[model samples]
Target: MDPVARQTLLAAMDAGWADPRRLYAEASTARRLLDQAREVLAQGLGVRPSEVAFAPDGPTAVRWAMEGLLHAARRRGARTVASAVEHSAVLAPGRHRATTAGDPSLFVEVPVQPSGALDLPAWNAALQVPGTVAAALQQANGEVGTMQPLEDAWDACRRAGVPLVVDAQACLGRTGAPTSYDVLAGDAQSWAGPGGLGILVVPEGTRWALPGPPDPDGALSGPTRHTPWVPLALAAAEAWQQTGATLDADAREATALVDALRAAAAALPDTEVVGDPVDRLPHIVTFSALYADGEAIVREFDRRGFAVASGSACTASTLEPSHVLAAMGALTHGNVRVTLPLLRVAGGRSEDVARFAEAIPAVVAAVRAEVGAPRW
Candidate 1:
């Protein structure tokens, strides 16, 4: 998180630690701060403050938005469509809904290009299905850094009379939020703010409903309806405001680093850089090594003083290969996902990027040799 955001949170934690739903003085102050945060988020998203709903985090907000849209669409039919490359949070609801509806295919998965681009044609076709109600296509992918054709996807959903929920967690502060989405979801932590703050934008008159019973005002209610913590929300707004002010320069610098990393990864033996080389996120890059394990590679890098993530089972309980890698038909093993900070305030620096790049090939090769993996 940005230092400013961090300090703001620390300060808020001290002063705004009251129940915002209550009518006390402390609660009133907390409510005002929370409202101010919501206003900032709404302005950034080009929506009204009334349209924004705060959740515990991004995934929860996504679940709420998805369930709401899907439930609202039940009148038309209980079917929805999404890109195969969507985050698990976006896919989980449809799967759960499908299970409850007694049909495994209640959710249709649209194929994506090897470059990680969404298959607009397939998405449109899925929308034409008799029971289709809402569709989900992420603004940009978190794993592969691929930017989806959102305008085109939104157009298709519009033509089919289906509401589109865009998971904008990856693109909100990095590239600015897209203006075309009917329902937008994002996370505070993604923009150098504290976690536990999820941003949900529900445009006025959007065809969406909560999965459960309605509240006193006829608004949809979920399992939890308590307002978010005042400080976290305020810090998120402050961080987002800062990100917006410096995004252009930060993006250029981060993109240069990513470009360099991409070139280095592509040049490495038995390695393939995944996602679009040019049309990807400015701060994230992923690559896979042949004949090596992703966890092994991540460990090797960590030992060498660089923190990186892998596409393979990150923990002992989850041994499944990344669905995102599988969707792109890329090597799932020996995968490394590197995400750099977007600004100096967030510890983003060219020196760190250079250090990581310089250490990559050696660490990867060392891991490969330890595993007795063959080089291509």
Candidate 2:
């Protein structure tokens, strides 16, 4: 979290400790804070305050958003169309829903180009499928940082009479909120806010419903089964304000740094830098080195005092091959993913990226040498 956001969070802990559902004075104060937080987030996202709903986290927000759309459209069609490179949160639930319904065709996974951009023709064709009730495409690929053709996809979905749910968790604060989505999902953590807070926007007139049975308190459609923690909401609001204030400047610097890192990685022997170089996230870069183990590369980078990630960005803890890379026909092994922090945040500066770029060639060589892999 940003230092200022952290202080705001800590201060909120004292001010918003009461449950907002109660009718006490402290509860009223907490309720006011929560409402204020929603307004802040809505303003930042360019949506109405009534359109916004909170979630426990980003993945949950995505899953709920997709499921809600699917449920609402169930009478019209049972199918959901999404790009193959969608985050696991979107893909996993989609697959599960298809499996549970005993219909493989219920979820259609459209392919992407090698640059990790969705295949526009394939996407349009998928939406044209008879049973597609909803379509999903991220504003940007979380794993490789490739920007999707959101406007085109939105137009296609509109023509097909399908609602589009955009997972903008990766682009929210870093790039800016996307305007093309019928339903937009984002994470507070993406903008220097604390984790455990997710944002969902459902514009007025969008066909959406809570996926499960009705809640007595009508709370299931909101952040959690109950009211969200007031302190976290306030902290997220503060983070959004702070991050948005410096977004343009921070993105400019991060773009230059990421470009340098991409060049360094691309220059390494047998290494392939993935994603669209110019039409991608400003702060993320991923590269794969042939014949090198991803974990070994991560460890080598860690030993050199730089934290990095490998395998699937969403499922890194499981060390699974990246489905995103596989969909893009890119090497999945020995991959290193870097997401630069905002320049205003600690350990986020030009110097940090420079040091990491300086070490890339040696790190790749050292890892490949240990694995006894040819560098050709």
Candidate 3:
């Protein structure tokens, strides 16, 4: 999170510490802030405040969206369809639902291109399947920074008479939300807001419903049990506000940084840049270095004061390849994922990229040498 937004959240906590569901004066104040936060996010996303619902976090929002839409679709004897590259949050619920229901075929997983973009033909074909009830596809992949074809996916779902849930967790405040979407899920943390807050948009007449058991009010809605934490909501709103007017500049700056990283891959032997090089999230770049283990590379970067991440299973004790990288047909070993801070992007700076470009080659070389692997 950025310093300004961090302070905003701290200030909100001071004022919104009270329960917003109550009727007391203090509660009323909290309620107002909560509603204002919701309105702010709604305005940013081009939706009605009434259509916005709160989730405790992004994964919960994904689950709620998948379950609610699938349940509604099941009323029409429809099943679930999603991309094979969706985050575990989107994939897990359907697996669990199918396991409990004793039918493994309740869900259909669409394949994707090696670029991490969904195969348009496969996506459309999946939706056209007679019983496809709910279709889930992300606006972009968080791990690889690949952007999906939202408009085409939306069109296919519309033709199939299915509700499409677009997971905007990676692109929400940082990029414009797609108008073609029926349901959208976003994470506050993606926009430098408090970690636990998530936003779910169920636009009017979308036909979503909670899976089982209704609350006393005769409705099941967002993942939260009671009123959402007002402070986090306010913080999320403030963070979203901070993104205004700077989105384009940030995109340009971050894209340049990512492009620089892509260029560096050529200088570093046994390394390959992953994702759709041109059509990707601006702030993220991922690459894999052969022979070096993911965990060791991450540690080396950390020791050099560069906080980078890796998707390769080699980092974990279990040593499983990243599902995302596997789906993209990319190398899974010695992977590194770098996400630039929002401030750097907003400021139109590339000094951070220069530092990374210098550090990465040395770091990878050292790790490979230590591992007794072939060198460039």
Q: Identify the candidate with maximal lDDT.
A: 2
lDDT of each: 0.83, 0.86, 0.82
| Residue range 1-376, candidate 1, lDDT tens digits | 8787888889899778887767999987887788788788878877877788878898888777788787777667888899999888878777887889899878998999999999888888989988788888888899999999999999998999889999988877788688878888888878888888887888878877675555553222122353677888889998988888888888998899999999988888888999988888898999998877787787788887788887865422478888999999998888999988766464647888888889988887887888898543
Question: Which candidate tops TM-score?
Answer: 2
The better candidate by lDDT, 1 or 3, is: 1
Q: If scored against the real structure, what TM-score would every candidate get?
A: 0.95, 0.95, 0.93
Overlapping backbone residue pairs in candidate 3 total 0
Q: Which residue pairs overlap in candidate 3's backbone?
A: none
lDDT of 1 at 192: 83
How do the residues 228-247 of candidate 2 rate in per-residue lDDT, one tens digit apiece? 68889899999999999999
Once superposed on the true structure, which residue ranges of model 3 sit more than 4 Å away at CA?
A: 212-226, 344-349
Q: What is the lDDT, from 0 to 100, of the residue 171 in candidate 2?
A: 88
